[model samples]
Structure formats: structure tokens, C-alpha cells
Target: LSAGFDVADRCHLAPVGAAFLATTSSGVAAFDRNPGSSDATIVTSSMLPAYRGILLPLVYGPGTRSQRSATPPRLTHGPNETFIKAAGARSLAVLLDVLTRAGHVV
Candidate 1:
């Protein structure tokens, strides 16, 4: 169950095995299927030349079930223009990379 950050946030009803590609203030995040714990893990920011982004593992907790009804703070509100632009650029770069790998000229 892959989706954008917004869609992923609303996916509180998603199955336990589902994973999502979510964007964060610093970089990108992915839902991790850690059955033993509910806490999400944050991997150190990668300094590798091929990839340079924070790896945040978003895990579903008891609160996730009620997220649909709760008024969660949105990341799209005021004063997030810079982060939005950076996230967009990173998304585009990933898309282009995937396309290029598939033999499509970009």
C-alpha cells in the first residue's frame, strides 16, 4: 500500500503489513513493520553519494487507529514552504531515477 505522505497519514485503517512512503520535514520516511514494538526508529542520515536523506521508520501504534477522528497537526500548514519545495524536488528526482532505470528517456 504505497502512497504519498498525506494519503498515508489518513491510512489509519490500513492493514498491519502495509507500508507507505511518507515525506517528513527533513527528508523521506517509510512505515516499518516491526511487530514487537510500536516505537518508530530513526536511522542516521545517510552521507552516501548516491543517497543523502534521513531514514525515518514510521510504526503504527495504538493511536494510529484513532488518527482518522483526531485532529492531527498537519505538516502542510503555514511556514513550511521550504520543506515542501525540498520534498517535491526529492520526489521528482526519485521518479526520474526510476524512469531512467526502466529505459525511459527523461
Candidate 2:
């Protein structure tokens, strides 16, 4: 809904205060590249129970081209944002599909 969070840096995002939202891979890919090795995905299962069932974990398959990590990292600070990252093309495609199914993309 928002173009981008009003933060000093691209890394800074809005506080998650109970909002229904999902993100695409292209966005997280750029962030991962910018930070040069950061957790591509951050989930707060404890805080948001809905997230547990709603989110589809982005797994790095054989063709995934983005940076890979042993375990996806979680957000350290405030703001309940989820970052799902993987191969830009496939990940983004999945995001589009999810958004389409969610009736966000017309």
C-alpha cells in the first residue's frame, strides 16, 4: 500500500503493529544485496499467530540464485515485518501469485 516506509535508510521499515501484509522477493533481494549478507526472511510466529499458517516459507531450491543462509534470521528490533527472500524470479513470482490469490493484484 505504501511506496516505501518513511525511514532514513532502505533497511528501516515501518513498525508491524498488527497489519495484514505480505512482501515480494524483489524487495527483499535488493535489501539483502544492499546489506551484503542478512537474513532474507524474518517471521514472528509468537507475536502473530495468523502468520504461522498464512506464510509460505520461501525455500531455496536448486535453481535459487539469491544469497543463501543456514537458517532464516528473525527481526531483532521492533516492527513486526516479514522478509521472505530467495531467487528473485521465482520468489517474486510466488509473491505475485500469493498477492493475486489474496485479491491484492487486479
Could you estimate the TM-score for every candidate?
0.28, 0.27
Off by over 4 Å in 1: 2-72, 75-83
RMSD of 2: 15.0
Task: Tell me the TM-score of model 2.
Answer: 0.27
Candidate 2 residue runs with Cα over 4 Å from true position:
1-42, 48-86
Model 2 lDDT tens row, 1-106? 1111112242223222111123434343222212322232343223366654333333332224322342453332324323445344655675566556556677
Give the candidate number with the greatest TM-score: 1
Q: Report the error of model 1 at residue 27, Å.
A: 11
lDDT of 2 at 102: 55
Residue range 29-93, candidate 1, lDDT tens digits: 44433433222322222234233222323333322232233345323223421234454565556
Worst 10 contiguous positions by lDDT, candidate 1: 16-25
lDDT of each: 0.34, 0.35
